[model samples]
Target: MGAEYGQEGLVSTSCDIYSFGIMMMEVFTSKKPTDEMFTSDLSLSHWVSKALVNGVTQAMDSRLIRKDEENFFAEVNCVSSIFELALNCTAESPENRINIKDALAFLQKIRLEFLVKLSEN
Candidate 1:
């Protein structure tokens, strides 16, 4: 459930977007909202938000670590954009979150950019 949906039982596209954002964060960060590192003040979203200021590497799953990979920089940039998108999707307010259509479009762009970068390597 999204923040609003979880708190107010308001079912809508926002809730589904929130769910998608959460899944993105979990999949990319390899950290669950209920992870031991997260507390009442710091959730997965919060963690990612903070970690991003430092660098995408901090928020990424260890398995994705590849500092020497041919497309490392592109991967970092793409994942960073994705983290930001997830954060937008998981906004505390439903009204502040992005729609699924926008999210999909953004992802398609990221995918294209990533593919181009990969090919360059």
Candidate 2:
């Protein structure tokens, strides 16, 4: 599956995106990507999914040093958008996964937005 579906089929980019998404979630939560805490129907992806359904604020890692409302809102929006893209990249069906170029563009946009927001401060 890894070879045919992930490598030869040109799904490597999508698989990497899935992994990157998982990593981003871990970074935001300060938890291992596949820790036991996320077991029992509470996988990291599931938690993120629920949070996205409700609101991005609910998904933020409490450890992150949020400065103020402006920064907080900006961060929330950035993370939320990233998580949404990640979710799409990690869908069960290969056909549902997003291409790598799109993922890179999304991440770049997020980074640029953060930079702009920081500069405005």
Q: Give me the displacement of residue 121 in model 1, in angstroms.
A: 2.6
Cα displacement (Å) at residue 29, model 2 = 1.6
lDDT, candidates in the order shown: 0.90, 0.73
Candidate 1 lDDT over 6-76, as tens digits, reads 67778998899999999999999888888998888889998899878987799899788589877789999
For model 2, name the residue pairs that clash.
none
Off by over 4 Å in 2: 1-11, 67-70, 118-121
lDDT of 2 at 96: 76
TM-score of each prediction: 0.94, 0.73
Instruction: Report clashes for each candidate as comma-separated counts.
Output: 0, 0
**Model 2 agreement with the true structure over 1-121: per-residue lDDT tens digits:** 2223644566565567677777777777666755777777677777888889897667777767475666777777778887887777667666677778888888899899988887887
